[model samples]
Target: MDLDCFKAYDIRGKVPEQLNPELAERIGRSYVEVTGARKVIVGYDIRLSSPEIAAALSEGLRTAGANVFDIGQCGTEQVYFATSHFGMDGGIMVTASHNPKDYNGMKMVGPDARPISSTNGLLAIREGCREPLGNARQPGELFQIDAMKPYIEHLLGYIDIDTLTPLNIVVNPGNGGAGEVIDALEPYLPFEFHRVHHTPDGNFPNGVPNPLLPENRTPTSMAVTASNAAMGIAWDGDFDRCFFFDEKGRFIEGYYIVGLLADQFLRKTGGGKVIHDPRLTWNTRELVQEAGGEPIESKTGHAFIKERMRDEDAIYGGEMSAHHYFRDFAYCDSGMIPWLLVAERLCQSGVSLSSLIDARIETFPASGEINRTVKDPEHILQGIERRYLEEALSVTHTDGLSMEFQRWRFNLRMSNTEPVIRLNVESRGDIELMKSFTRSLLDDIEELDGQSLRDPQLSVAL
Candidate 1:
């Protein structure tokens, strides 16, 4: 077994190469040994390779003396739901979340949907999988279950929509498993929906369903504009992250959605602690505080945020990456909840999504997020830290490297799963200053590479 398959967060790789039946079977046995769980729930996405991988994994689990509850063909959230809903000891979701079609991976959750990351139990699983210690003493049982309908019902319980006003809405499932869930929920939903690429085509004819990419969002934005819809939503591969487009067909930053959801949760929960990623706007912090709740910041990534939420007992946690986690939902992120709340908020306020986010935009201007490919991401990050961060700002390395100024802050960190360094800059309603600072930093980065940098202002305008 290749150790490289075990990523910083989950077990992921190219299908049949890095991820195959043999490797999945080994991981199954390893998971049983690491967690010492008798029964594990297994789920997978709509990818072409998912069925085979799920079977292989279950085979390994049964071989390791663990009964497997196979929840066939579902999103990552469904696996999380099943793990907690059925009181299973652990769960595994075979997916490649937002990655291209050629890739697939597994996300593991312990009891209560708590994630097992590299630093926690994933390393042990990796090491154990590398060396198989034979099969189980006896064959374990394998059973099948349909968790999607129940999962949809559970999501619907989070929001009240009895009197939701009908409005034109657009949804792009991006050819992922979300299409099936959306198909089931649309009839029950109170809206005129315009769907694009909603079909579950494993070929992903429309393109990869990752709305994080500017190119991937083009279809959703165009559809929203053409249909004159009130709002538009797009989901990633496993339906864990959802991206939004306003009525104007402009992509809304996930930070604003975080603040919106935080407000909604706070309204219902009577002001508790809210956990958020350190990447984007402090508007979420302000919103939480204004709602009489404590605001806590965590490192970027779902695992870290979920762990922090559990520790702080946060009512909810959100990241600018569009991953929203709820304490009521076993501290697991759900792509379904964010859009549901958006609809409810729109209905309650009788306002458009643009109108709702416009007020916050005035107070909290941001540069969105920027990803730059560099020869050495670390050297560029160190350069920025030594020159800009160490001298004038409060610095921290909770995720990669984050620095806060008096009124503006930015996080520059190499991606744990990719080679590029991700940059997120936010300012206090100063778009000009944000552009200047971003350009200056990019200029610094380009200087290190001896290449003339492009217009940073232009890069951010989009």
Candidate 2:
């Protein structure tokens, strides 16, 4: 078995080459063998290849003597819901999640919807699937079912229905699986949705549903401005993570959303614990402290965050990449819950989204995540650290290498799932300083990438 498709968190790869039905089936058997899960729930997203892969996975699971619940065409979060809500031993979601057309992947969770990742279990599954030594047992039962209505009701529970105000909002599912849930929640809420790319088109006529890209965000931004919405929200293909834009059509960084949400939850819960990733930390830490909440720092992946949240009995957990987790929700991340909480915050505060985040923006300016394909990411990271170490105030490797200076700090790390390095820079109440250092860093990266260094500040997109 060629295990090139197995990643740190999930199994993702290009179709036919890296992922196919045979591999998925073998993986399904491996999952049951490795986890000893007798009951499994399976789902797929709005990808052309997802259905076939899911079918094969379910077949393999059943053949391995595990009963399977076939919840067709749902978001990754729905699998989390089914796994924990029904008390199943395991769950699998077939999705590439913002990857290009030829790509597909799967996310798995053990009992209680807790994540299964490389640090804990993924690599072991990879090893188990090779050679398929498990003898065939009597096939287990497979049942078809729908988990949407229950999932939507759970989402509504995150916000009080009576407290919501009538506000127009722009919603872009990007032709992914989120449109279904949004439509289901419409009749129960007072908000009018300006829906775009609302249908689940597997071919993705509007391109893959990744709102993190600057190009992918323009549609949502324009829709917000044109519709005069209170805010705009966009989700990835699997709808596991969601992005935000204010009424003025300005994109809000996911890092600040972490702080904003921490403020809202902390105020309501009256000083509980909140877990945050180590990527862009200053704001989240300060916001949690100011709101009288304890901020716990965790490593920058779902598995790590979930583990830390469970250890601390945290009320909530957030990552700068838009993944939000709730203790009430089995410590699994949700794309739906975060936005609902934000909407409730807007309603209660009676303030525009831009105004709500303006002060925080000015107080902690940041360069949004920038990615560059590099030949040797390790070399560049080492070089950057060597150049900045002399003047650094503190250095930490909570997730990646994070170096803090007097006025500014940045994190440079390799993506666990992609062939690129991600860079994030921020300054304490100084946008110019952030901009200048960001430029300097990017220039260094370009030179390290073996390309002729052009000016990194050609335009200030952030």
The lDDT per prediction is 0.86, 0.90
What's the count of clashing pairs in each model shown? 0, 0
lDDT of 1 at 40: 94
Residue range 105-175, candidate 2, lDDT tens digits: 99999999988888778998899888654645688889998888788889888888899999999999999
**CA error at residue 106 for candidate 1, angstroms:** 0.9
Candidate 1 colliding pairs: none
Local error of candidate 1 at 50, Å? 0.8
| Candidate 1 lDDT by residue in tens digits, 249-354 | 9999888999999998898789899998877747898999999899998988888899899899999999988899999889899998889988888888888899
Candidate 1: lDDT of 338?
Answer: 84
Model 2: what TM-score? 0.93
Query: How accurate locally is residue 97 in candidate 2, as Cα lDDT from 0 to 100?
Result: 94
